[model samples]
Target: MEQDLPPVLSLDIGGTKLAAGVVTGDGRIHGWQVTPTRREEGPRQVLARLFDLGRKAVADAGEPEVAAVGISCGGPLDTATGVLGCPPHLPGWIDVPVGALAAEAFGVPSALENDATAAALGEFRYGAGRGTRTMLYLTVSTGVGGGSVIGGRLHRGAAGNGGELGHVMVRPGGRRCTCGRHGCLEAYASGTAIAERAREALATGRPSSLAAVGNPTAEDVSRAVESGDGLAREIWDETTWALGTAITDLVNVFEPELVVLGGGVTRSGALLLDPVAVAVARDAMPPAARTARIVLAELGAGVCVVGAGAVAHDLLSGKTPGKTPHA
Candidate 1:
């Protein structure tokens, strides 16, 4: 199908899954594909599978050819260099030149972006943050990740990882964070953290619905909360508290018009959004709280793909430096 904007191939790499799609200018995705990441296979093997998935998406998209390739993954990756550093989620994946590889494989230039940063752009351009001048986005999944759009521009931060909103300290000396901090928001609010807290509670002989499952996930905890499980509620409440505390700080600092939450954990819907919104409303600085509305992301799963495609579109349109090729 002919598109107003040239279609681009976009890929999202997560520790647990890899997704690819052809994204058009309207932020719509065609030929979406997803598969288990199986990180144990290591970077080289996993990337081979990811590239294969991209090819499948392209074929399914039925486009004559992709204009460019865009990649989204966890940081600390160097977007300028397209190198994947050691992300906690994908342990041992270090210094891999993902962009160059994609460029070579597809015979087109490629751009790499931090996954959360791309999602922020996606939300700002076409999702929940559309029509908003300033926005904050957080994806609370395997780990907490964040990005922001300030003054209608994507903020890449000084290091190019964008703002590490997830690293905002929520508790001084509480749970250990993957970044080695005592109590960052990710330590308390990530899906991994929620599951860990629930499992720990069950280990202490606490009576709860989660105890029935040998290994409960964040989704399991959310389900338990829906059924009025006390232990699950406790974990969910703490998760919301950490998120609210951190977001309150961000709202005070950025004063964004909207804060959009996405990722797998957000599948809990109002069970997660209502409390966080209430806490931010009740606790954030008055002016900032009044302007900021907490909302769920409109692009449920293909956000990063569309965001990366947007970046590719920008590169092609000369909005970004064309270090990469359009064809």
Candidate 2:
């Protein structure tokens, strides 16, 4: 029966990029494709392109039929209604019925999930949290997003986005977050925040290797820090410090067995993971800290696609809503 179901089609909508893939039972992606999102184009135009991309992925994968479609995007969205609800990343998108459209386009039922929530399911099913009973997944990218699996169940909060982990106030009266909040962890630790801090520092006419970067990105800052650039190092320290502080708080509250960090920011590897791990270990409640391991996500860039596919797979398998099947 499992083999009789067609491979699932998965789509991920991000502020900066759109991705699509066909996922098999073993959690591998076939015919993966990614393109710039160009959010200024508005939802209709973007969805058209996204659907075309999905079609291309399906054709390329040579999977003649898709049993279901799964879509992953940043929230505030309603998974129950499959509507996009003014996600800050997508600017003008508001209450767009993304899942219904996907279902119509592919002639299959569709499931929608918060991108981070989908990623959590993805990592839990096939990545770093495979054998763990409880895990937290945090994505520090264009923004900071998180999802949790508690008691071996994916926890989609009442609002369906689980929690806005980035919105945790790490500094009072600090930088403003996209969610219109001040002093949130996203204000300091996200990739956008890192780049913004570097640009702000450079604007003050300080001397550093980053000065040569023109408009330095977060990656540039990490590379500069690796090369011993003092200004970059300072910005990096603050980023890691914010991550550590927020993660420490989360570890205390959730007592997860593992915290898996993913997203573009984690590409810095040890530059980001080491300091955050140290901070969580030294700062969280001893019992929580002793039981939790902080680690990099094994799924890397394809996590969301696989996650969305996993969601679709559950649908085909007749799994009940809000239930997570064990790995």
Q: Scored by CA lDDT, what does every candidate get?
A: 0.90, 0.90
Q: What C-alpha RMSD separates each model from the true structure?
A: 2.3, 3.7
Instruction: State every prediction's TM-score relative to the real structure.
Output: 0.94, 0.93
lDDT of 2 by residue, 88-108 (tens): 889989899898888888888
| lDDT at 67, model 2 | 81
Q: On residues 1-327, what C-alpha lDDT tens digit does candidate 1 reach at each position? A: 124788999999987889999998888899999999999999889999999999999999998899988899989988788888888789888798888888888888788889999998998998998899999999998889989999988888889899988999999999999899999999999999999999899999989988888899999999999999999999999999999999999999999999999989999999999999999999999999999999999988888998888877766765543235335
